[model samples]
Target: MGGFVRANEPEKVISLFEELKEKLGGGMIYDGTPYGNLMKAYFMKGMEEEAMVCYSEVLGEGSKVRFGAVSYNSVLDALGRHEKLDDAIKLFDRMIKEHDPPRRIAVNLGSFNVMVDAYCIAGRFNDAIKVFGEMGERKCTPDTLSYNNLIDQLGKNQLVGQAEELYKEMGERGINPDEYTYILLAEACFGVDRVDDAVGYFKKMVDLGLRPNANAYNKVIGGLVDVGRLDEAQGFFDQMPEKEVKPNVASYELLLKAYVEAGRLDDAIKTAEGILLDESVAFSDEMKELLEGALRKVGREEDIAKMYEDVEREKAERAARAAEEKARAEALAREEEERKKAEAAAKEAAAARASQAAIEAVLGRRKEAAKEESPDGGSNADDGGILKRLGITNGPVEEKRAENGNVVGASVGDESVKQDGEAKEGAGSGGAADQATAL
Candidate 1:
């Protein structure tokens, strides 16, 4: 049955239950219990008529099956939950009529609590109070939950004094206020600008050994934020965890807004960063996105520019490193090329020296033989003497002379051509002089 409910196939189960009830011979079984369960399901499914009919049928079964207090509360709770208060009251009256032992049959606090809650929700605070009064008259003393519910409802309705008076009444009745009780009264006081009063109740909550929940802290923080006491609000926020209470999204948002309103933009930004980065602080996607938008709206342009500057600096550093690496590689390649060139040049110089030495030795021997053949031959004298002095001569002398003559003649011709050079120089000078004279 739990599986059926979780699986959202209640109708299938309802049909099966109906078949089982029909086959089992109705009076032998407690069919009334399932009706209440089905009522809850039908209401959840928005099948109000079916739920009410199920209730009516159970009531018709009378004392044969004990419909019990849960059954009565179920119908009441369902009708009230659906906002069918009038129907809920009618069913409550019917339950009163169906008491087996008549006068001895008692309605418990649970049933009364449901009706009280219903009246409170319906804004019949006077009627709700009257019902609570009657419960006392009937010796159904209001419990802690009863007072808490009433106080919460009154606070929500903005009846701060009324909530306080009820708290006083509960205290007079010897019902020691719990954490929820104080939280409710504080909320009421906060709503009505009674910050001092709210703070008093919060102190009482602490004294009573009741750990304030997030809502409790939020109510107080919200009050502080509203009064523009941001520093005090911050103090309270800082105290939350020490009290075993954690700030929820509402608490954080109230503080953030306080910081913003106080013109403490840095504080606001830090608070937002904590929310975003703190591992222990869980935030919803909606809240995260909302804070991001708020930060962008309030963030300074200089701050953004600084952030971009840091990013650009990092990028420039990376680029410089990459350029240095490229330069180093180029230098390495150039060094390798230079080393290869130096080695090749050294080898070429060594080979040239060896070839020159062999040519000089061969020319020396040839000159000696020529000089012996004709002692007066000026050819051997000039060739051997020049070769011996200069250290060269292995190729043809005529070729050498032609090569040397081309060199010598070009040099001598250049010296001999000085007159023409002087004539051109003088003519050029004369033209300049003539042009100058003309000008």
Candidate 2:
């Protein structure tokens, strides 16, 4: 059955299992190894439901099959791989609780490690931590794999501090970290912006006789570049060839991007030339575009006409984006202008209304004053009072009556006529007195 499973013949394996079950009728017993093999076959064939059924049949109450730790671990691994993390945890718990003491299938460190890895893959970090804690309770000291799994997940999730603590604990517990451990620690340190710590760990990995690979070098260089340590990154990148760890396309691309972003166009051109010169590294279109952009930045041209189309396309995209931004800005400006205009017009309208109200209020007060002055339809006293209130006074008046009893002349303040009449009267009286005395 295992051979069949290895040969990718799941149907034949299943048929064989069915035939074996039928031959070993009612009271017969079988161990879990065959069932595990069958489950593995089902899992390999993408028949997850059938695989789970096989696992259940092994642990079923009526079944005489006794599953050992290896079989249980296999099923647990399948469950984890299938993203059935909750089921895997349940199975792990069952193994610990149900299979202990009687020792039908004792959970081992591999079981815990599998569960931890599953939880990490599912991003269930808390659950993974719980499993890690359970290892200590079970007196199962965690190995390097356990630490690496946890650290890698935590680092990827950007939980660098926790990853660092775990790495420290590994050293304290005398678990010699492998190259993978060092790589994870360096990555975690880099994730948290601890560039110096990352570099130290990377170097420490080399000192421990774990050959630093291209991946390790790339990580350190990338970290340095991320922190704007372009010079340091370039220096490290230059050392890759000496270490016999040839620079990969990613390494060159990182250096190129850093140089371009830092305005070191000359350095970027050199890196681009290195990329082009290396026959091992495939010149992908992305790399070509990056190189072309760097060349343009330094006001240089390349004979690679294939890259010209990409450059022109990028330019068109940039122009379109710029135009969209300009249009959006213009719209915003127009809105702001309209808002200001509306506010000003509203203010002007309010001012006009206020001015009209003030004028009406003044006119109303004058009307009230006029009504108070003239209670009747017409009153001379009231009119005179109004004139006096206005600082106008009536002067003296002279009147003349004609024969028809109609007043023809009415003059005010005729001082010259009054003076002449007074003088004539005085002379006439004097003449009468003198004539009477002579008589």
Candidate 3:
């Protein structure tokens, strides 16, 4: 339903709403969103009478959706947009007067804002102020945004004096002014030819730390130029630099066009030079043509052309320098990355070498252990005791034979007897093997 209304399909919304109402036995939801959409749709299709029925007469029959602040505010906005001031007033009055639950909602900040805008558009500045004043009574106090809106609309309508009152009132109320508030007041003062006040607002905005944008600066500068105060306008423009605010093409053109109109070709040329030097803003083609037209009036067309070419050449050189500097930085970064990688690789190789050395030491010790395990005492003098038990000796060969487990006890009588006598002689040295040999 909201989509239908937003899509401007007023007829679909109305028809579907009716169908849903009848099918659901005249029960329509009214949480303000759909109702608001429906009302806006009616306003779009010029069905204000039907909208009024939904707003006041019908009361949604069996629908449990109560009309709260949102619903009331929505309708009020719709009325304001459609230029139904009388209807908006009635609704606002009812919001303020009605105090019962579900039916009478407390007027919120938005409720008064709608009325303020409505009155502002209707050119009733006094009524607008009155409504702004009444907000505190209703407990929906107007904040900075509310004051700004009122000031803007009043400014647009040429009510600068009334706007000034609001501005002072904002300060008194402790509602801190934003950059936009100052800009609006400045422009409004300009519209009313209060040039001094306009300049003061611009400067005060800067002094108060509410930095004005390029548009705000340009507006004040342009207003000054319009009143034949070229030097003052130029002064404001000069202040932009010290303030660190970048001016756009319009900012330059305001003063440049003024100089050209007054036949100050040299000043125009100087401004053109400043425009080119401004690194923050681009020098557009229109600005070039304006300067060219101004110089051509003095028959210095070729000079202006050559000056523009020089500016372009300077810009190109600056760009090239920037690119070169970027490339140098990137090269340095890559070199640092490569150095780190090389260091890491060196450390890895050193660790691998240390591990290899440790493995070789372990294997060398194991080789010595392998020799020790051989029963023949293979190159290890530590195995001499076991050798004696095996009875293998150039000196004690019988003892060595008996230690080797040669079981010839009874089969080889003479040899055994001989070996046994030798074993007995070596018994003190051979230990257990000599006893076995004797047996």
Candidate 4:
């Protein structure tokens, strides 16, 4: 149960508590600490309604298990999560008025920090300052965490002077600024176009034992770049190693963009290429697209025209290859067609020879039948022999009789034989029809 609550697993902790209550009777885990932990988890998970229910349940259990500053602070944090600053402030007011012994909710640094950030985000910097004053009035001296939050809020409101004042005050109070504080302050200076001021703050940040992180360098470089101070920005980039800091995407992008704006196209292209290929620097898709667009924008007209020429050359090569392939395919088709025609001619010649052989065989059989005929009815026997040789097995004699000396029983009544005769004549004539027929 404790692990679940600490891990921000609110639903699991709530179930465990409910189970324990059911098993050991109603008030088993109604203590302030358990309820407070449950409330914290619920708040962390943004389960405001559940946290409220637990708050009321614990409050109902007994005054002995009263809602302390932690409970009220969790509710306040939950309200901040929901972005209900007005409601959050109202709850804070209620806590201040209620809670016997007037327990201050300032015990939780996170709660105060969140409220300060909410005020800043909501553009209520005045209210944030008031909260800081209250923290002081309550004898709760602000730590570096508290000082960072207030400085960040003031800076976000474009109060660079006030932000600087607060920094000096932190120093006086011996509350040193952290890396985030310097970054935020540098950002504030950059936001208001205070590049020189930003540089000064950055140097101070490094002197305070806070290593200038990537964002800090980016802020300074970007500020210098924005003011067209390319030389100074380059100097900062070169000196990053001395401060134990490293350049990131923003640093490179700012320098590259400065070069582009200054018409130093070659340098811009080189730097962009460097950043684009770096594995550690994960160039955002949008940034990569922008870099490509920037190159096109900065490239000379002659360079662009050369690019088109290269594309045209490639297209010509592809077209030539395709034409070659097509020509090869057509030649192959013609060769295959010629081979098929040759094979068909050989087959037809073999069939014609077989037919002539069959005709000779039939004539030989007819001659043998004539020699064996009975001499007393020689005419009738001759008709039978002729009919047998001609394959006229089922027809009246009149119908089977030849017309104009044509072999009626031998022909199948189709014009194929006449067409074959014409085709053979055409082949021998050397005309267009002859050429087609030969092929």
Q: TM-score: which candidate is best?
A: 3
Give the distance in Å from residue 379's predicted Cα in candidate 3 to where it truly belongs. 31
- Tell me the number of clashing residue pairs for each predicted model: 0, 0, 7, 0
Task: Please give the lDDT score at residue 52 for candidate 2.
Answer: 78
- Residues 297-381, model 2: lDDT tens digits: 5667753453445446666787899999999999999999999999999999999999879865764565467666664643232
Q: Model 3: per-residue lDDT, tens digit, 1-439?
A: 7788768899998888788778767865545555666777898898888776876643434546666776777778777777778978877886777745455565778888888988877778799889999988777779989999999999988888889889999889899999999999999999988999999998898888888878889999999999989999999898887888888888988988899888887888888887887876676788778878878877898879778787788889989999999999999999999999999999999999998798657645654675778776443332333333434232221223345454323222246666865666565457767678999
lDDT of each: 0.71, 0.76, 0.78, 0.69
Where model 1 places Cα greater than 4 Å from the true spot, the runs are 1-31, 61-65, 94-106, 261-263, 283-439
* Candidate 4, 1-439: lDDT as tens digits: 6688557687887788778778877764544555655666777677778877765665543546545666556556655655667867876666656633333343445556667776777778878877876766545677988887788778777888878888888878887678877787888888898778788878877777777777778878888888888888888887886877767888888887788778776666556655644446765676555555666775554653444465467667878999999999999999999999999999999999999799768856775666577574333335444755587543333223333333333223335644754555555555656678889
Q: What TM-score does candidate 4 get on C-alpha atoms?
A: 0.52
* Best candidate (score: lDDT): 3
RMSD of each: 25.9, 26.0, 11.5, 22.5
Give the CA lDDT, 0 to 100, for residue 182 in model 2.
86
lDDT of 1 by residue, 1-439 (tens): 4356557777865776777777897544563456655676787787878887766666654536566766667667767766888987887776656644445453667778888888888888888888777776555688999888888888999977778888899878898888888888887888888888888888888887888788878878888888888887888888888887767777777877677667676676656655644456765675545544555777664654454465467667878999999999999999999999999999999999999798778767777766667656534225634454554433234211232122111112244444654555576668779999999
Worst 10 residues of 4 by lDDT: 405-414
What TM-score does candidate 1 reach? Answer: 0.58
Off by over 4 Å in 3: 1-29, 34-65, 99-106, 269-286, 320-439
